[model samples]
Target: MPPGHVADRLAALVAERESQIVLGLDPDPARLWPDAGGDPDPAVAVLAHCRAVIDAVAPAVVAVKPQVACFERLGAPGWAALAATVEHARAQGLFVLADGKRGDIDVTATAYAHGFFDAGGLNADALTVNPYMGLDTLRSFAAVARPAGGGLFALVRTSNPGAADLMDEPLARGGTVWERVAELVAELGDEHRGPESGLADVGAVLGATQPEHLARARELLPHAIFLLPGVGAQGGRVEDLAPAFAPGRAAGLVTASRSIVRAHEQSGGAPAAAARAEAERLRETAWALG
Candidate 1:
């Protein structure tokens, strides 16, 4: 535990920022500026790209979702880039969400918690967790995050195309697997809810691609902040995400990466200019709905 509840912390930031757009930081070395770099180590270029993206979109975003796998793929250097990125994003007054989707039992889970919490050095405001291992796994994470004012967004329903194979499968008990996962997240949110924000430290990662699920997921976990990914390039319209804002203006978060960062592809302008413009566009669109 660090100090306050992450749910409330996020709510305050959202209100102040007046933007629910979460900038997704997925840096692909091969696609970086110049399309080719002489920086012997790709991670170096990756770091530069990440920083530029942050600088470009900070004004229109409330947080940045750094795909952990991108940095982790570079081994030690990649990990260092991740830490640097988190630090830089924080310095810019932007919230950081570590999108590692880690899950395990006992020490492994505990260790993962440390990485997401301030002590482990990741210093992320919130982490995305995989709850398939069961509630016990989530409990371990929540225990470490709660007192720190950090938060967790357990994977209740993901945005991947194949997610329905498991998440939408029918269970003997009733409803789909995702529905059950929603129930667990809702319970966790209720239990760890912050009185001030009327929100839970636990959150959910439901796909923006599947707008139908938003209403149901919100119904299940009213206080849990919904991190709806797969917007922008994935064809998820911002206008269809109204239900996610039912809990309050801060309840739903719409995330975009390539669409904003790669806007130059469509606009034929400088990377920074295109990114900032796209981010601004998204901000106004989502803010209006809120």
Candidate 2:
């Protein structure tokens, strides 16, 4: 990796924070905290809710993954809110991973990259991408992101049960579809491996709910960082993800959204306090595995 590669930066942050937990910010207008304040505009309220959550959990997490659709659904105001939320997370010293899952080829793919990695755009540290479109599409996104010290996390085996419909299908070439994608992830990330961290700027989004697939993913993409989602509300346990940390703690980032943000609902306390506690708990659990 170069001096300021995204993988290096990410590993540095993980070490500094002593945590690999990524706070997932998928705020919903209807689900805003009771004390998220009395903003009349839904977009503004959503931003407040996100900021509050970030403030509460920032100390325990190294990054935040904001689901783009949550903000995009509200139109222009929502877009602005998303930008503001990203800024706020950065202000709190957290890496921002824009969860857009964008995919395309040629100019369209480049456009998505700019929208997330450029100075005038979200300028996120990383973005989730869909690799179904093939390597050329990934190369296009990386062409833009890598130079900017940003990274891409390609979707691999996801947490959804329906993922089995495609990802688990046996290929005529003698491997599952997701396994092939993992090989591509490894191939594309090969040249961008970070020297200090030994992690690639290109990473994989491996759902934590599917712990069984982790060892295989590691075998194929040894140098890639793994973004493990589906924890908390998605029924994934941090204890089951031991294999993902084999490459190092920063190699596996465990993302939890509802479990952290909506923690008060189950624990019975102020939203911020509950969120902070839950995030800390996750941080400790994941850090121990490392």
Per model, how many backbone clashes are there? 4, 1
**Runs of candidate 1 exceeding 4 Å displacement:** 1-3, 35-38
TM-scores, one per candidate = 0.96, 0.98
Which predicted model would earn the best lDDT? 2
List pairs with backbone clashes in candidate 2.
1-195
lDDT of 2 by residue, 1-290 (tens): 12398998999999999999999988889899877846999999999999888988899999999999999999999999999999999899888899999999868999999999998999999999999999999999999998888999999999888999999999999999999999998999998888899999899999999999999899999999999999989899999999898999999999999999999999998999999999999999999999
Each prediction's RMSD over C-alphas, in Å, is 1.6, 1.5
Clashing pairs in 1: 1-147, 1-148, 2-147, 2-148
Name the top TM-score candidate: 2
> What TM-score does model 1 achieve against the real structure?
0.96
Judged by lDDT against the true structure, how good is candidate 1? 0.87
- Residue-wise C-alpha lDDT for candidate 1, range 1-290, written one tens digit per residue: 23577777788888999999999988887788553233779888888888888988898999999999988888999999899988889888888899999999967987888877866578788999999999889988988877677889999888888998899999998899999998988887789787888988889999989999998888888888999999988889899999999988788989999999889999997888898999999889999997
